[model samples]
Every structure is written in structure tokens, then in C-alpha cells.
Target: KKKKKKKTMEMSLNLASSSTSNSVFLFNPILSGKQLAFPCRHQRIPKRVKPFCVKSSINLSGPRQTLSSNWDVSSFSVESLSQSSSRLPSFEELDITNMLLRQRIVFLGSQVDDMTADLVISQLLLLDAEDSERDITLFINSPGGSITAGMGIYDAMKQCKADVSTVCLGLAASMGAFLLASGSKGKRYCMPNSKVMIHQPLGTAGGKAMEMGIRIREMMYHKIKLNKIFSRITGKPESQIEGDTDRDNFLNPWEAKEYGLIDAVIDDGKPGLIAPIGDGSPPPKTKVWDLWKVEGTKKDNKNLPTEQSMIQNGYAAPE
Candidate 1:
């Protein structure tokens, strides 16, 4: 190879051209595993710095995770790509946004699987522990999934010290609707166009006759539990809830409010009914939630020791 002079190559380069053209020239000759250095007029700039390249692994774990990696290059223009990459959030901005969201907001926009349940419950518990007096907002827009997972979230919301304000954005269906109704009373709201749907727990059982029988029994138990929840929240009869949920029962915002599923239809700027505080009245308290405690089931305390029996033993309390 002939050795080229630095002065000859410097004159051929155009300073007025776009930075992308300069980048192309910088990498073209280096593909053959050889160092190609070019001289520039600016002495203040550092010389012979190689471009940094990053290698990333493709994740194929889930639909959501996989979809983020597969981008259509033909859909985006080069200018849009350049602008998007240049305008990424700084570390400080990202940290601030994350902190704000964790402190006050719990958004549920996807199907409520075990992972979603865990994340929402953990955030609610942590926020309640941090500042019990402050209210936490939960925005839900889910088509519903996993009755067991949704029940976990419902229990967590009841156990938390902070009052959760549930808001419906697009649609809250099935388990999602149940969670919305489980929020602190007088704090539930749905948008003007949002839809709320309720129905019986759905599942597909596959196996022998015994296994199918067990699955049917379990599903019936969940349906009964959910019906009781709706009855309690909406102040309706359990029979009425059962009849309505026999099929898909979708309600508009006005219909939801009329059915007592939500307190108000959010039309103005007010985010549902405000909780009354500092009016010489006792603050509202939360009940201890027991997921397995179905109604009409009596606890057998016959085996438990009474106070009289405790006195005969050494476990008596002294005055």
C-alpha cells in the first residue's frame, strides 16, 4: 500500500458537510483491521480516537420484552432516529421521574400476572410504610388476568396504611375491575369514556375427570368470593351480582357510578371524592383482610383455650 501524505487528504475533506458523512469516512477504511488516521486543521481536538461500539444481547423471554427488541428500520426516518437518540433522558432526569412515580403512582396497564401482582403489591406496601398519611394513586387499564394474582393485589391494598385512589383510564375488566372496586371507598373514579367490565372467573381445565372436578370446584369458590366482593362494594344483592356476572357485563362511566362500582365519573378536574380529614372526626380504618375467610364459614374456637383456663395455668395476666 502507498503511504498517503496528511496535507493531500486534509484538502479533500469538506468541513461544511454533515457530521454523518464525516462518521462514514472515519469507519470505512478501518473495516480491514487496520488503523487509518487522518489529520484535521483543529489542533485542540484529540487525535486518533476510535469509535466506541456496543454489543447487546437479544431477549426472548416474553411478548412484551421481545417486541421492544424488534424494531422496523423501514418505518423510521434517519432524522427521527438521530433526534430520538440525541434526546434520551439524562440520568438525573430518569432518577427523578422514577422516584416520583414510586412514591405516588402505581400504574397497571398490562395483564395482571404474578409478576405484575408482585410489583404493584410491593410498591403499595413500600409507599405505605414510607408515608402512611400521604395518598397513593393507582391507575389501571387492564383486560384482566390471573384471579389468584389479582386477589393478592386486592389483599395488599386493603392491608396498606395509605388510602389508594384507583383510576380507570381505558378499560378495567374482570380481575382489574375487582381491584378497582377494592380501592378505598369514595376514592374510585373512571374517566368519561372509560369502560368497566365484570364477569365470572374464567379458566380452561385439562386432565382426567378428578382433575376437572377439582378445577370446577376451585373456580366456583373464586366466583362466590368475587360475587361477595362486588356485593359489598356496590351495595347490591349477591344474587343480582351473580346474575349480572353470568355473562360479560360492561358498564360505561355513568353506568358504573349508577351501579355503585365507582364513586364518580371524572369529567372536571376533580379526581374523585376527597377523603374528609381534620374535622374533629375519627379517621377511617381498614379491616384485616383474610383471603380464605368466606362468608357463613364459622371459625371453630372450641379447641381454643378460654381466659378461665388460662388463669388455672401459669399464663394468667397479673393486675
Candidate 2:
């Protein structure tokens, strides 16, 4: 009976030792003061102990067993770095590139405000400083804004060492007209359908009667100065200029040419003396007016009255 009891005790001790070798112990420093144990093999884990199995495989080859966790830190870092490297350049970078390439094409397609004037002046100065002999072209398509801004650009154009050739693409009105007229003689140009408008300086006066009167006198002086400028540019009598500028006067390309406001109207086939900037092709021959013509209408409307219409309409005919 004693031998049989001793043999049973030895078998029980062997089973306990095998279980302890296969089991993994984990210590939860944060959750519990005691150590929790789990089976190391792939088997049905107890429902209460499922959360403790962070890793499915264990390396038992070394004295220190290593758990194969799901976190692959090296691969994650590589993916993050690749994503950052593939991003496109921002708008500021594109703007810088455009500014560098668009040095020769000076676009005045907005209101001639202080900002516009400053930009135009700086571009003109840069162009002149780069190559004084190279002719710089100024494209004016403004409805016209601050007279002060216009004067600033006008003075810069006049003072620049480069010969500025102005082209009117669409509407050149008020101060815009002044800019067009300021271009180098024989180089001033206008698109066939573009319009040019001129008028006296306009403003609103406020404050005391004395202040208002002073402002009026100042305006009159500017008006006279503008009249002289117009007379000089158009080769017209100051009286005629004053009468024409009493209200807004709009002129077609042909009328502008006759009035000495523009040297010539652009012909697509013949760009005349105007030279292209850099490697840019010459302006296309298709005039805006031609695009708007009726499909079957006469190509040349000879019935249209000539400059004689100016005299008949009570305006001085161009000489």
C-alpha cells in the first residue's frame, strides 16, 4: 500500500512540472500586483484570460524568450517618410517660377491702383537695368483707376532707359489713355476692336468751403495740365481738346490712329515694326471684331463713313 501511494505522488509531481514549463507568466505592473499565467501553445484560451495574450508566438531558443508583437516600427517609419516625400510644391513656388519667366510680358490688366503702379514701375526698372537697349513692351488693358498711380507708372516709363512700346488690348480709358499716349511714338499700337476713352480728372471734394475751393483750383490746374498733354499728343488745339474732354470720349482703333492716339492698328499677318519678346510668337492675326462679324456679311463695309463723319458730327476732323 505504501509503495503504490509513493508512485501516485511521483506521477502527480511530473504532471505539475510539465504544465509549469509550457505556461507563460506575465506581470501587470499597472493592473494587478500579482503575476498572471497563460498557455504558450495555440489552443482555446479561457474566456477570462483572452485579453492577456498580446502575442501568439514566442521564441524559446535563447535564455530570454521574446514575444512576436504586432508592432512593425521600421515599416511604419518607412511608409510615413515616403508619404511626406511625394508631396507637390505649393502655390508660392509656382508664383516664383511665373515671375521669373514672365519678366518681359508686363500685364496691366487691372485697375491702376497703388499696387499696380508699384509692380509696373518695378518691372520696367528691372527690364531697363537688365538691358537698356532692349525695347520693353507695356500691355495696357485697364479701365483706369487712381490718377496718382497712373502718373507714377507714366513717369517711370518716361524715365526708363528702355524704349517702352505700349499696346492696347481691350479698354484703355482715362489714365489708361494717358499711358497709351506715353508710349514711344510710332510704336504705339491698338487692337482693331479695342476702345480708347479719355476724360477730365474726376473726384469728390469735401470739407469747408475754403477747402473745397482749394481742391477745385487744384483740380483745374491738373485739368489744364492734362489738356496740354492731350493737345501735345493728339496735335490738336487746346480748345478742341478741352471741348472733347468735357465728357467721356470713346474712340475706335481707326479714330484713335487718326487722332494720333495710336500709331497703327494691328494686322495679324503684318505685325509692323513691333518685335516679339524672347521666343514668343507674334500676335495672332484674328481681330476681335472679325470674330463677331455675321457669317454672310460683307468682308469690307465700304458704306461706312470715313473721317468726314467727324466733321459732319460737329467734331474736328483729323488732318
Candidate 3:
């Protein structure tokens, strides 16, 4: 019963150019460090005085690589800033004419019953009825909450008329990660430091532990329900999901991908966040996902995708 320690970092930046402005958002993991370190936060430089580049640099100890962002004058959005937070994702949708065709989208964020899904659904409705389409990348960063809620959101994603891609940021553990993976039309992805965990669901009943028999039955029920969710995503057996859940260790990005959980490796393209605790938390982490996938499907318990296969496919090399 070992656990993998995980760190998730979130960041945001506002950029201005004439009448239009844009915000870049990201959530990345410091999953590649020996000592669990993070980079320094950068100041928001004034747009006029700022160089053409909105440069941010980060250095981490051990296997973690240095991450930097230096944007060019050419890379930017032309949309005006007279917008609402609700309107932000709408910018990602596109317009296609002479067809009722819709684009793919995988909307991720908070767990079900969370406001994240509501906004996503409404946005999709607008895109659908208004004669436009979009495929989406749902960038997810959540610790997980509410099992039924998560499944409800997943169903919504399936019902969406377009393609959906879910990019895991930070921790996609528990139901949060579960729903995130469910969004992919083809497959799921994770950042280098991303972590995914699944275990039997748990609950604290007001009834005393003295009612041990009933509680035992209830726990078993939860186990079955959780196993079903895992089975749907990975094509793995419920028994396997139970085994992994009971073991209590977290799976790093590579392990997750190998297990048929994540499809590829992607950088959320953001910095790790450091709180005042002075541990390995800082800012200046801006990252984005560019998908790279290996071909071939799963067989037995092995993962094979190339003419040259992996030396060891399941675990990330230790930091």
C-alpha cells in the first residue's frame, strides 16, 4: 500500500493588444522532480511597455526539465475583452458553413454537480442551435468529488455531437480523472507530471461502525459501481480495477497511458504553483498540450504500439 506523492499547479495570464485581449490558462504537474521543486512567479508586465514576448522562465531540480514561455508578436487572439468568464470557452468554438456539422469537444474541469459542466453544456447548445461547430479540448485539474455527478457529466460529453479531447492536468484522481477520460472520443492524455488514480468509492455513514454488516454490504456496492466505471474507460476487468484500487498507489502519466487510461503524453503548458508554505510551489508555469499518439490497440495485459517497443512501459522513470 504505497502512494505516489503528486503536485498540481495552476496559472493564468492576461494579454492585451489594442482593442482585443486574451487570457492563457494552464495547469501542470511537478511530477518530474526528485525534491519536488517549482519555478518562480513572473510579474504581469504592462502590454505597451512589455517586449513582444511575454517571457516566463522556470527551473526545477532533478529530472524535471526547464520550462520557459516567450511568445511572439504574431501569436495572439484578436477577440475583444468585453467578455464574461462564461464566454471564455466560446472563443474555442469555430464556424463552418453550408453544413449542420458539429465539431468535437471534451470539456473538463470540476467534478460533476460542479458549475463547470453547466457552462460547458450551455456553450454546446449555443454552438449547436446557432449553426456553428467546434471540437474541444477539456483541460482538467481536479481532486475529484461526487461519483454520480461525474458520470452525469460523462454522459453529457458522449451526447455531444462533436469530437471531444480530454487533456489531464495535475491530478485526475478519483472521479475527477474518471470523468475526464470519459470525454475522449478517441483517447485521453496526461501531462508529464499528471497523475490518475482509481479506487473503490468510499462513504461515511452516520450509522455507527457497529452496524458493521450493513456497512460492509454498502462498501461492496460502491466497489462494484466504481469498477464498472473503470471497466468502461480502460476495457480492463472490474477485478483488475478492484486490485489497483485496493493497492492504494497512484499512477503517473506513463503508467496511466500504458494501462489504457490515457492515450498520449501532453504538456498542460503551465507552471507549478507554490504556496507560502515555501515547499516546491511557485508560478511562471505556462504550458499547452500537443498530442502525440502511438498506434496499435491493447492485447492481453501488454501495451504495444511501435516497431520498436518500450523498454518498460508502465511507470515513469523515477525522478
Best by lDDT: 1
lDDT of 3 by residue, 1-319 (tens): 1233222221111122221333332335655533333333445787676548654555444353211123122322454324433433233233321111232233455555657666666655554444324454566787777665666666766776655667778888787767656865454667776778766676665566558658778767867876787787788887777766763447777667678777666543222121112232212322331121212112322543443444256443334
Q: TM-score each candidate.
A: 0.56, 0.56, 0.46
What total of clashing residue pairs does each candidate reach?
A: 0, 1, 21
lDDT of 1 by residue, 23-67 (tens): 334445645534444433333456888989887675656454321
Give the per-residue lDDT digits (tens) of candidate 2, residues 175-280.
9999999898888988766899999999879999779879989889889988898899889999989867866888887778888898877743336445433332
Model 2's alpha-carbon lDDT is: 0.75
Q: Output the number of the TM-score-best candidate.
A: 1
RMSD of each: 20.1, 20.9, 31.9
Question: In model 3, which regions exceed 4 Å deviation?
Answer: 1-114, 124-133, 208-219, 267-319
The number of residue pairs in model 2 that clash at the backbone is 1
Order of quality (TM-score): 1, 2, 3
CA lDDT, candidate 3, residue 45: 81
Identify the superior model by lDDT, candidate 2 or candidate 3. Answer: 2
lDDT of 1: 0.76
lDDT-better candidate, 1 vs 3: 1
Worst 10 residues of 2 by lDDT: 64-73
